[model samples]
Target: MKRDLGRGGIVVHPYRGYGSRQEVFVMGRVFRQAALGRAIPHHGVLRDVADVVRRIARHGVAGVRVEASLGANRTTATTDRDGFFDIHLPLQTPLPQGLSWHQAELQVSQGDDRMHCHAEVYIPPPETDLLVISDIDDTVMYTGVADRLRMLYRLFVQKAHQRTAFPGVAALYRALHVGADGEARRPILYVSRGPWSIYEMLEAFFQLNCIPVGPILFLREWGLSWRRPWPRRAEDHKHDLITRMLTMMEDLPCVLIGDSGQHDPEVYTRIVKEHPGRVKAIYIRRVDRRPDRERAIERLREEIAHSDCELVLAADSAAMAAHAHAKGLIAQHDLVEVHQACVDEG
Candidate 1:
């Protein structure tokens, strides 16, 4: 899908890479300004329409060179027609997993297209006790992702700094990262159905609100084009991604977090059933007000009865924190901090 060479200029779109002490994996895309979009003034519904139009006009540049560098080690690959590239490099000297986040540079080059950018490659510490995998939309923030029009309004209308997170989410995540004894940097990974286009905005949202920094994995590129559905559905993508994360670290068990506004309950329930004893707990924020939705969650509770996994449909972060504390997922002091954070938000 070779796109036209544009005066819009080429930009490097490197996602936050992930790896361990042995090697590092890097992934990114190179596209015109129209693809990732320029920081232009946009307002309301019309702005949403403009975003879609830009994506439809975007294709990709083939055979662009990409170089990924970490410390003295460097690796290279070329972008496909979709302008995407991924490279796995074995290190002569492996990085210590004690380092929470490792900095890596990605340099993109073609005939006239040349750009250099930085990507944060994440490596979970060796002492990580419990892994936390969470969703971004309604689970962390106030976005109505299950509702498309409302999701559009919040996404396109608000700036990154202006977007609001659910109360006490940052504190809850931090507590999970710094385990029960408060000495561990338990790995916390954030997953989203959203495209790679909003990576900067999402990163800003996390940092601005004091959430724990970890590898943020997005399932695909932007879904703006009306071409086809997506590479895969949301439920399928999330389940597979989480499964890979769990398989990556065999010793550490995970606690999954999401909202009731979407298919989180269904996806997570299946995961818990498939891999018994792998998931510690499932915390889902009760977003939908409908009784049928509530009953749907209750049915999920019955479905997971054969397993020891606890499915909690909580009303707020405070309640969820209390539940996690009682379940020994977090410490008592951590619960207190989460409650205090909620009070501060008010």
Candidate 2:
């Protein structure tokens, strides 16, 4: 569920979190009059530019105290220098059966001012078979990440709805989330190399396109400064996140989805090699046309051939869906919907 800003200037913006039955981890930020409100439908390039500026200019309130409670379990933490608070609350009692989504009450205070909000937590049921982890940039949406200038233009000037998703992606993700039986409620987690400033834009993009909203792990603020000019390597960031997810959910196998652009192939290949049998499949979208890149990915595919995971480089979402159906990751009827979505989106 989405939370609204409180009356005070202070706001607690909580991202979706996932955890096991024994413990729940939730994270959010405390900001002063800098809440990125819901992305409403709007028009004009100037408005889009203004929206991006507003997002970038927002500042966090550092050192604020944050308290989180899930039922009787409670924990407290102070915000980091970036005003981000991460809380790990141990569960005295296991979560109720059959409930996939749970809410945790969050309150942030600095001096006499305080603000309250709810954080959503996702815990996959025991019956879930596969955990889906996907990349956002070129995998799900059309952000020309390989071309820096074009990517920046699209990122800074496009509204949520104006930004387009690849054909049939929504249906494919939906099918993956529901599983073959159409009864399992599997979690679909997304990871991005983008910074936290664009969080609201991505959230609105998921809601607008009907994609399942999961915990989106994003990078921290990056800019040209005296302290640090360059951002961390994208490969390192994504690799760390995937490994953390695998460690957190040790029982469930994972389906890795990414694009040919950048280091997804290398990063995912490393994950497959390091965690053998844990990754069921690796789906790479063919976003780049370079032959050398294709050959490199092919070598990676062959390298992982000994493992149980299959590396699939697909030209379109329909191809991925077909492979998933054959592997029983998605239902047979869902394939039809994916094909129709391709045609409709085209």
Candidate 3:
């Protein structure tokens, strides 16, 4: 996808997509840039605020037609009121072997204006051992999500490179992506309660921090509009997305990762109960040290103890990595790297 934005033209922002061998799911937004606007500065506090405002103030092009094609398979979709289009294209035949990433051509047109971009679709190789789903906010980075004011302040004032990821997170995730054999090539998907407005920033953060990127799924914008007076519950949104992912890749069991700052523990526990043999393990970062929260999570841990899945409440990435290594989810050498990364980051 193109990084630089040009003025006064139609632009399609295609996100990374994921799918099984038989079908692909992709989504993107279309925007018509204004012809007259000064180039925003890219430094200092005021510039960061301006950039945040610009990203949230985007006006989507509604009713525009979007066409996506992969090989001989083709599909068309129209943008919704929010200028977002989702395409689910079924492959004419299974994708070729030994190739995990495939490029799909995306074209958006309305009247005389047309724009084109290429989206990458990922399909886990047959050697994959399991799927990994993780929450983004407190689990992967230091977002201060438990404190709304601090989170909002940092969200608007900090650039992507300025954001801080937890120590050893990159190494742990990389180890999970390449499972115990060191060649498993597992797919790692991230989910967030954040709106789509910050998609670019999060993408840049992943690149800057060396986090393995897969399909990043986020909720829609939230406000006090008449159509949506209140945002959807975080647990429900995350639960639905995880369910969809598990259904899409039914052959593989998965490992779930999240933080205890919010509803991750509860949501993941519900998933474990609902999908009995499908969950290999659950890792919850101990972001909230409240006694009540700890006791609640302990009860949940015991509830799922009878099943194969183990709920581990870890204090940091190193703790999680150690458990994962013992469970044969990651390689032994990867655990050493994660421990060293923790020391180096500290």
* Better-scoring candidate (lDDT), 2 or 3: 3
What ranking emerges by lDDT with the best candidate at the front?
3, 2, 1
RMSD of each: 4.2, 3.3, 2.2
The window of 10 residues in a row where model 1 has the poorest summed lDDT is 1-10
By TM-score, the better pick of 2 and 3 is: 3
User: How badly does each model clash, as a count of residue pairs?
Assistant: 0, 0, 0
Give all TM-scores, in the order shown.
0.85, 0.91, 0.93
Give the range of the ten consecutive residues with the poorest summed lDDT in model 2.
1-10
Ranking by TM-score: 3, 2, 1
Candidate of highest lDDT: 3
Q: Estimate, for each residue in 147-235, the C-alpha lDDT of model 2 and write its tens digit.
A: 76777667666768789999999999999999999987888889877777677788999999999888887754554344653455555
Q: What would the TM-score be for candidate 3 when compared with the true structure?
A: 0.93
In model 3, the Cα lDDT at residue 264 comes to 89
